[model samples]
Target: MAQDKIVFVYITFPNSEEAQKVGRILLEKRLCGCVNLFTNINSMYWWEGKIEVSQEAVLIVKTRESLYPEVEKEVLKNHSYSCPCIAKIEVSEVTPCFYRWLLQETGVEI
Candidate 1:
C-alpha cells in the first residue's frame, strides 16, 4: 500500500476535441492517471478588463505534484485557448487501493 498524496489539476478547453488532445497526451506520456472531462460547462471570466463567456469543457487531471510543471508546459503549449486556466490542489489523503492504482497507471513509485 502506498501513502502518497494525489495532485488534482484543472484545465479548460474550448471543446471536446481539444480536451481529448490533452487527455491523450497526458495518458500516453504517463503524466496523469486520469482526466475527467466535463462537457457543457459555461465559463465566465474577466480577460483584458472585459467579461468573457464561453462553452468550455473542464478537465480534472489526476497526477502528482512532481509532474505539474511539465504538465502545465505541455498543455499551455498545445491548448488553443488564450491564457488557458491551469490550477492545482493537493490531496491530503487517499485510499491505498486508489493510490496504488494511480501510481501504477502513471508509472510513479511511492
Candidate 2:
C-alpha cells in the first residue's frame, strides 16, 4: 500500500463466525486496521501426513508490519482451532485512500 506502508497479513478460519471473531478482536485491540472476509475459498494443504482440501473463510488483514506479531498472537488467542492458518505476505499495491485510512486508524507512523 502507500509509499512506505505494508499490509502483510492473512488468516483463514474454519467458518464465517470464526473469521468474524478474529477480525473483531484484531480491530478492537488496534492490532489491525482492516480485515476483509472472503466467504468462499478452496484450501488444499497437508496436515498430519494427509492432503486435505476444503472450503474455508479467509481473512485478509490490513495493518503495518510492526503490528504483525501482535496480530498473530491475538489471532491465535481467539482462533477456535488449536493450530490456525496465518499467511503473511507483503502487499504491493493498495489505493492511497485505503492506505491513509489504514495508517490513520491504526495510529501508525507513515
Candidate 3:
C-alpha cells in the first residue's frame, strides 16, 4: 500500500436528505475528513436490465486509503440502496498543508 495516500469515495444518493444523513454519520465516526454533497445531478445507468435516469445527490468523501474498508462498511450499513456506488479513487497528488489538515481532521495521525 502507498504511504499516506488520500482517497475520494464517491457515492450517489437518491436525494439530498440521504446524502446529508450519511455524510453526518461518516463525519461523526471519523471515517472521513470531509464530504462534499452535490444535489440535483442527473444520472443515467443500467439497472435491472434496463436503462434508468434520475436526479441524484452525489457525495464526495475525503479520507485516508487505510480507512476505506471501514468507510465502505458504514456506507453499506447506512445506505438505502441494496448496492450503493461506493468507489474509492486514490489521490496521486496533494499539497502538504491540505494533506496535513486532512490527516489532522480525520485523526489519522493521532
Q: Report the candidate with higher TM-score, 2 versus 3.
A: 3
Models ranked on lDDT: 3, 1, 2
Q: Which pairs clash (backbone N, Cα, C closer than 3 Å) in model 2?
A: none
Point out the higher-scoring one by TM-score: 1 or 2: 1
Candidate 1 on 1-110: residue-level lDDT in tens? 44446899989899988999988998998989899999999989887999999899989999877788889988998899778889998998878788788888988665
Candidates' TM-scores? 0.87, 0.80, 0.91
Off by over 4 Å in 1: 1-4, 47-50
Q: All models: lDDT?
A: 0.87, 0.83, 0.92
TM-score of 2: 0.80
**Residue 82 lDDT in model 1?**
70
Ranking by TM-score: 3, 1, 2
Top TM-score: which candidate number?
A: 3
Query: lDDT winner among the candidates?
Result: 3
Report clashes for each candidate as comma-separated counts: 0, 0, 0
Model 3 regions lying over 4 Å from their true place:
47-49
- Candidate 1 displacement at residue 50 in angstroms: 4.6
Error of 2 at 107 (Å): 1.9
Q: Which of candidates 1 and 3 is the stronger one according to lDDT?
A: 3
10 residues in a row with least lDDT, candidate 1: 1-10
